[model samples]
Target: MAEAGLRFGIQLPVQSQSTIYCEHWETEAGPAELAQAAQAADRLGYAYVACCDHVAIPRRLAGAMGATWYDPVSTLGWLAALTTRTRLLSHVAVAPLRHPLLSAKQYATLDLLSGGRLLLGVGAGHVPEEFEALGVDFHRRGAILDETVQALATALTDEYPEHPGPRFPFSGLAVSPRPVQRPRPPIWVGGSSPAAVRRAARLGEGWLSQGDRVGDLSAQLRLIADVREQSGRSGPFAVNAIPPALYVGEPGWDTGRHALTGKPERLAEALSAYGALGVTHLQLRPRSRSLAEYLEQLEAVATDVLPLVRS
Candidate 1:
């Protein structure tokens, strides 16, 4: 049902260990494991390898959202050196947490160092405490994110970019080592809220859904289309989805009832449904017990499932 072939990518583990998605093995893993995962993604022809971002985690939420979030800029910058072709993605950096210029400087250098393989995924962060700590108003994060996205577009595109705004206003200052991507690297807005989707349509090159149910995607896509039409924006806009955790074949251990498990053909048939819903790319998390098992699953996806996805 896909209008075109669907692309696949992975959100690198051992970085951010949220109770909702983190596998048991990731807790014991470290940088070596992270590098291997990125390397495998690169060798296996994945579209990108994603990293999460969080400046700090309040103790109240630390138990659930562990404080293990590796800085996306630092982590992705390191992974960039290890992988050859896989694009580096900040799964949703809370850009409003810092000044737009600082964000621009960090990402611009990353794009330059990575030879232009950067996907700047931005989001309005959820934690109120984090905003307070950073001197950013939690309630105004959405508006700040909008302005930040616009500022980033200009900053990444021009060495002496200027933008006058209520939140961030600057001119005449120059940032060196501009992003290698012409007109700037793709900015993918993340979140499933109505405001988030509208921002993506208006400002972003793509939309990164935050675990929206498959049943909800059609409505979201329609909303994106409506907003884009209203805004008179037209161009290539990627639609991304994070499907349920996947396992290529029958799992030896319990992968839970929600996981998509079975033979490659069955898995492909299930995954291809997202394409029918207008998802251009998928961010997959494979269910596994260890790094070895994780790599095996990635191999299975690349070899057994990927070939049959479009067929």
Candidate 2:
């Protein structure tokens, strides 16, 4: 059964062109198409619209990951100006690559400007070469990410934040334009590893799973619950899932066997299963051949699929 109030959001296309998921049509699409999709999400009552981050891609991995990765902070800032209601998300900003204060300065300004709508999804980055290029220790990324999250919590909440960490330490420094969200915007930890799950439980306001299978998520959820309970943390924590590639109604083209296709009710039933797994937020990727078809998919999700899921 679908959990009551299971919220959904889309990963805005044309921002990252990873060969793993990017449609052929997205190759020809650009900013105007991106804006239109975001605006539609805003108008249609999606909870958030998310963008991915990558400082730069090496030629070695460029064939698969692509080279069109947009800076999440800049893209989200632009989306903030374009939409009024929908929250802005980084999907997973690699925080360890940059100092927490620098991130805090940029994100705090974004939250203030966006009227308190920011979900800072952070991850310990995977690409070692990118880390090397930026002078961040690739092997120590997990530890660095842990400290970075702690520092970000303090920096986002306090104008004059202090951190005694070894790698990035500072005190008595003030960052102006405090965030609109009280005490700071929500930080969502992203990744599916054991350490990442624990990090999300201990520090994040939410957990953004990196495409973990539905069958695998229950164990992870149990792990999160155990960690939070042991740590004596008490508050609402958002649990997220990314469902199979979605295409509302029957697709005239191949959507692959992994995709959830057909009528609104069928799609709703499958999606609502995430809610049953204790997932509170869903990241949806709609398959399309062109910009018009993409918009149509979004519309179908909002008008037909969401209502059934909600009910």
The local distance difference test score of each candidate is 0.92, 0.92
User: Per-candidate TM vs. native?
Assistant: 0.98, 0.98
Consecutive 10-residue window with the lowest summed lDDT within model 2: 1-10
lDDT score for residue 23 of model 1: 93
**Candidate 1 has which clashing residue pairs, if any?**
none
Off by over 4 Å in 2: 1-4
Tell me the deviation in Å of residue 89 in model 1.
0.7
Question: For candidate 1, what is the TM-score?
Answer: 0.98
Model 1 lDDT-worst window of ten: 1-10
* Positional deviation of residue 53's Cα in model 1 after best superposition, in angstroms: 0.7
- For every candidate structure, what is the RMSD over all alpha carbons to the true structure, in angstroms? 1.4, 1.7
